[model samples]
Structures are given as C-alpha cells and as structure tokens.
Target: MAYRRTPAVQARLDAQREAVLQAAVVLLAERGYGGCSMAAVAERAGIATGSMYRHFSGKSELAVELFRTVVGREVAAVTEAARRESTPQRRLAAAVETFAARALRAPRLAYALLAEPADPVVDAERLVFRRAFRDLFAEQIADAVAAGEIPPQNAELTGAALVGAVGEALVGPLAAGGRHPDEVIPALVSFTLRALGGSHDSDA
Candidate 1:
C-alpha cells in the first residue's frame, strides 16, 4: 500500500523543508553557489547538519530544490498579477511589473536562477519556468492584437523581445544595493506600454 500523509503532518513537514531551502538560498547567494556547504545551510536553518541530509540527499540536491522553489514563486507572482487585469495591455504591464519587482527584491536569487547555470537541474528547471513566462506573454500579446490594442505582428518574436528587454534592463537596478523594486516599476510599466503601442493610461 502507498503511504498517506495527513494534512497537518504534511503541512508541518512542508514548512520545515521550506525553511531549509530558504536558508540554503541565502547562503548560496552570499557565498557563490560553489562556496556554500551543507553545514552552513544546516546552521542557517537552525537544524543539526545531519538534519539537512534527512530532507535532501546532498548540497547539490538541496540547491536544485531551492532553485525550483524560488523560480516557482516568481512565476506564480507573474501569473497572479496578470490574472486580475481585463485588458491585454494591463495584463502585459502587470506581468512585467511582477517580474521586475520580484527580481529586484531578490536580485541575487534572480541572477542565480536566471543568469547562471550553476547546476544541470537548475538549468533545466529555469528553462521551463522561463519558457512558461514567454508563452504567457505571447498569449497576452495575441489577445492585445485581437483587441486592436497592438498591431498584429510576430507574436513569438515580440514576446521574446519584450521579456528579454525587461530581464536585461532590470538586472542592473535589481542588483544595485539600496534600491527598492517600487522605485523601478513605473519606468518598466511605461517602457513596456510604449513598446507595445499601448499607453500607460491603460494602467490607470
């Protein structure tokens, strides 16, 4: 028979695992990915070094798990931000803002997950998460075209261009110390709107 996890027991275990991963991300970001150790992660997590092994087999496995969690959260934010808006333009702007804000808030994590291929597992998962974002953006662009908000053009090319632009443009400010995500959201929103032939007024 298959083992079953009770809700409360599952919740507790999930929380503990998340704490471990959270500690790992902070350490990985502070130290280079290669520099982080299982001991350091265990210490940061307030658990015995052996305890981390119970949750993850090794440092590389833990790192991959953390990468998946971080990318999942960021993508969820983008999806939520886009979900509430009615107009395609608003959805696009919200999606860009969500991506920028999250990346800025956790720039190191963003750089690790998006910019570097530290591990094969991370590389594979990151590609999937990124492609999901691209497809969602392209779909929004198509909707905007259908609504006559944007010109009918190369949807995939347009989506990829916009996503790349936002990712590259924000990397600097995001990685810069003492800058808040809110500080750059408006500019991002404005730039994306103009590029898509939509006005910033759509957000108003």
Candidate 2:
C-alpha cells in the first residue's frame, strides 16, 4: 500500500527542507562552493550527513539549486527595478543601480555567484542568470531606441556588452567586500547611460 504523510508530518518535512537549503546558502556565501560540502551543510543544518542526500541527490545538485535560487532572486530584483520607471533610459539606470547595489550589499554572495570558479553544472547555471540579465538590458535598449531615447544599436550585442562590462567592473570590488565604494551605482549609471547615448542629466 502507498503511504501518505500527515499534514503535521509534511509541515515538519517542509520546514526541515527549508532549513537545509538556508544552511547551504549561508555556507556558500561564507566559503564559496569549495567550502560548502554536503557534510558541512548537514552539520550546519543540524541534520545527519546522510539525510542531505534525501533532500538533494548530491553536492552538484544542491549547488545548482542554490545557484538558481540566488541568481533568480537577483534577476527578479533587476527586472522589477528596470520596469518601474516610465522612460527606457530611467529604467535602464534603475536596472544598473539595482544590480550594482545588490552586489555591493552582499559582496561574498555576489563574488561567489559571479566570479568564483565552480563545477560545470554550477557554471552553466551562472550562464543562465547572465543571459537573464542581458535580456533585461536588451528589452530596455530596444524600448529606448524605439522611443528615440538612444541611437540605433544592436540590442542583443549591446545587452551582452553591458552585462559583461558590469560584471567585470564589479568583480574586484565584490572580491574585496567593499560597500558602495565611491558611489559605484551612480558612476555605473552614468557610464551606462553615456555608453548607450542616453541622457545622463538626471541622477540615477
């Protein structure tokens, strides 16, 4: 006969799963992928090491899941910020600021997500978020071009360039765990606006 969990038992299991995932996130942020082993996560989560496999097949699966969770949250934030403003230029500025600001606020996590070398699975997951970010920029660029806010440009190429430029610029700062060093968001906003031929008169 098949067995079904009682409501109370299922709730406990759900809470345990959340605790395990949270523990993994903290460990990953604190020590990068290399330091976040299944045993370590289990220990941090106050569960038996063997139990981790019940939640995740292995370290790779856990790492990939964590990557998706973390990067997905970041992408949502950037998307929301980008769509908040009416003008495409303002939306682009907001996107840049939101992305940079989040990275600055959580340098360890940001560095781990953006710059740390990881297993191929996790690297592929990183690429997914990178593309998501590029797409956000592409949408704004297309809109701005249509509205005559910026000159005609290859939106895809330009979006990729922006993502690469922004990620590269933040790597060193993120590695050093610096917060809002020298008005990074403003400088980035100004630089991005200028690069896209958008007006830089308004502060981002």
Candidate 3:
C-alpha cells in the first residue's frame, strides 16, 4: 500500500512548495532563467538543494511554474484594465497600456518572460501566454467591429498580429532595460489604436 500523507504533512509540503516558487520568482526577476537553478532557488528559500526535488522534478518544471506564476499576474492586470473601459477601442488601449506599463516597471522580469532563452517547456508556456493576450484583444476587436467603431476585419487574425506587434515592439526596450516609458508607452498605445483603425482623438 502507498504511504498516505497526513493533513498536517500535506499542508507543510504545500507551503514549502510555495516558498520554493517564491524564491524562484525572485531569482527569475534578478537573473532570468539562467539564475534559477534548483540550487540557487533552494539557497534563496533557505532549503537544501536536494530538497527542491520535493516540490519540483527539475529546472524545466520549476521554470514552467515560474512562467505561469508571473504570466498569470500579467494577464490578470491586463484583463482588469480592459474590463474598466466602456468602449471597445478604449478597452484594447487600456490592455496594451497596462501590459506595456507593467513590463517597463519590471524590465528584467519582463525580459525573462518576453524573450529570454529557456527550456522548451518554458517556450510552450510562452505560447500559451501570448494566446491569452490574443484572445483578450480579439474579444474587444470583435466588439469594436460590431459597434462600427472600427472597420470590419478578421478579429482573430488582427488580435494575433496585435499581440505579436506589441511583443516585438517591447522586446527591444525590455532587453535594453526598458528605457523611456513615458515615450514608449504612449507610442505603443498610439500604434495599437492605429492598427485597430480607430480614432485616437479622445486619447489625445
């Protein structure tokens, strides 16, 4: 028979796992994926290197989890920013602004998430992350088209293109430590608005 963990033991393990992930986040922010080895994370979390295996099987697994943790927060922020806007164009702008602003605020972390070289597992998670943003933008684009705020277009394709555009536009700045947010963010927002073929007079 398999040995069963008691509730207390299980709770302890869960908390330990959380601590490991938190330590990994700090490492990722500071040094990207290269700095997030199990030993480094274990040291940061005040645990033995071997103990990390209790929470994650290896670096790839930990990297995927870390990517999810960071990306989840980003997605939520963009979603909330979009939710607060009344107009479709405004909602899309808000999402872009929020994403760009947050990325600038955390350049190293953003660089790691956006363009860092990492394991195939993390690359897979990155695709999922991009799709989430694409879908969010597609929803607003569809709305804008329905309301005649923008010309009829393929919302899904446009959404994916916008996601790629934003990511590519930010990659340079993110890699360069996110210089000139005031200039970069507004420029990005304006670009996104123009791409959607919507009026920017109100934003101006």
Candidate 4:
C-alpha cells in the first residue's frame, strides 16, 4: 500500500523543509556559494547528510530555491519602499536608498546574491531577480517621465542601467564587509538621482 502524509506529519515536514532552507541561507551568507555545500547545509540544519536528499534533490536545487527565497524578499522590500512614495523622483530615490541601505546592512548576503559565482541554476535565478529589480525601477521611471518629474528617457534602458550601476558600485564595499550605511546610502541615492536627471536639491 502507498503511504499518505497526515496533516500533523505534513506540517512537521514543512517546518523541517523551512529549517533546511534557512540553514542554506545562513551558510550562503557566511561563505558564499562555493562554501555552501550539501554536507555543510545538512550539518548546519542538524540533519544527517543523506537525510537532506529527502527534502531536496541535490545541491543545485537547494541553492536555486535559496536564491529565489532571499532575492524575492529583497526585491519585494525595495519595491514596496518605492511604491509608498508619492512622486516619481521620490519613488526612485526611495528604491535606490532602500536597496543600498539594506544591502549595506547585510554585506555578506548582498555580496553572495549580487556577485558570487554560482551553479547554472542559481545563476539563472540571479538573472531573474536582477531583472525583477530593474523592472521595479522601470515602472517608476515610466511614471516619472509621464508626469514630467524627470526628463523623458528610455525607461527600460535607464532602469537596467541604474540597477547595474548601483549593483557594481556596492560590490566592493559589500565584499569588504561594507562601510557605514549612512555614508553608502546617501551617495548611492545622490548618484541615482543625478542619473535620473533630477536635481540634488530635490528629495531622493
């Protein structure tokens, strides 16, 4: 006969799955992709190495899932910050600052997500999240252009450009364990504002 999972048993399994994912994230943040092996994750999760295969197919799948969960949360945070602002420039600035500030706060994880080399599966996820971030900026830029808050430009191109530029600028600091949030966020915000063709005197 085939076995079926009871509700209580399934809930416990779900919790264990979440625990495993969380352990992978912590390992990735501490040591990047290269250091986060299946054994390491299993050990960190307090599960036997072979037992990990019960929850995930292999390292690649676990890494990809970890990338999705963490990066998805980050993208949501910046998106929400931008959405809350009333103006295009303000929205852009909020997104930029929120992204930079949060990244600076978690330098190791930011570096892992933004710069570390990974398996093809995780790399694909990186591209998806990168585009997701760019799209958030693109939407705000399009709105700003329509409202004449900033000069008209190719919203798609500008949005992608901003994401690349800000991401590159943060790489060094994030790799070096980061600098003061106060210092990095304002600089990134000012740079993004200028790139968007807005005045420094205005709110970012």
Look at candidate 2 and tell me the lDDT of residue 113. 88
Q: In model 3, how large is the Cα lDDT of residue 75?
A: 94
Residue pairs that clash (backbone atoms under 3 angstroms), model 1:
none
Candidate 4, residues 81-178: lDDT per residue as tens digits? 98898888898899998898888888989998998877788779888978998899999999989998889999999999999999999998898788
TM-score of each: 0.78, 0.92, 0.97, 0.94
RMSD of each: 3.6, 1.8, 1.1, 1.5
> How would the candidate models be sorted by TM-score, starting from the highest?
3, 4, 2, 1
Top-lDDT candidate index: 3
Candidate 2 structure quality by residue, lDDT tens digits, 1-204: 899999999999889888988998899788888888999999999999998887799999999888888888899998898887888889989898999998888888888888898899988988898899999999999999999989999998999999999999999889878566667777888989999988883743
Model 4 Cα shift for residue 2 (angstroms): 3.2
Candidate 3 weakest lDDT stretch, 10 residues: 195-204
**TM-score of model number 1:** 0.78
Off by over 4 Å in 2: 1-8, 201-204
Better of 2 and 3 by TM-score: 3
RMSD of 4: 1.5
The list of candidate 3 runs beyond 4 A from truth reads 201-204
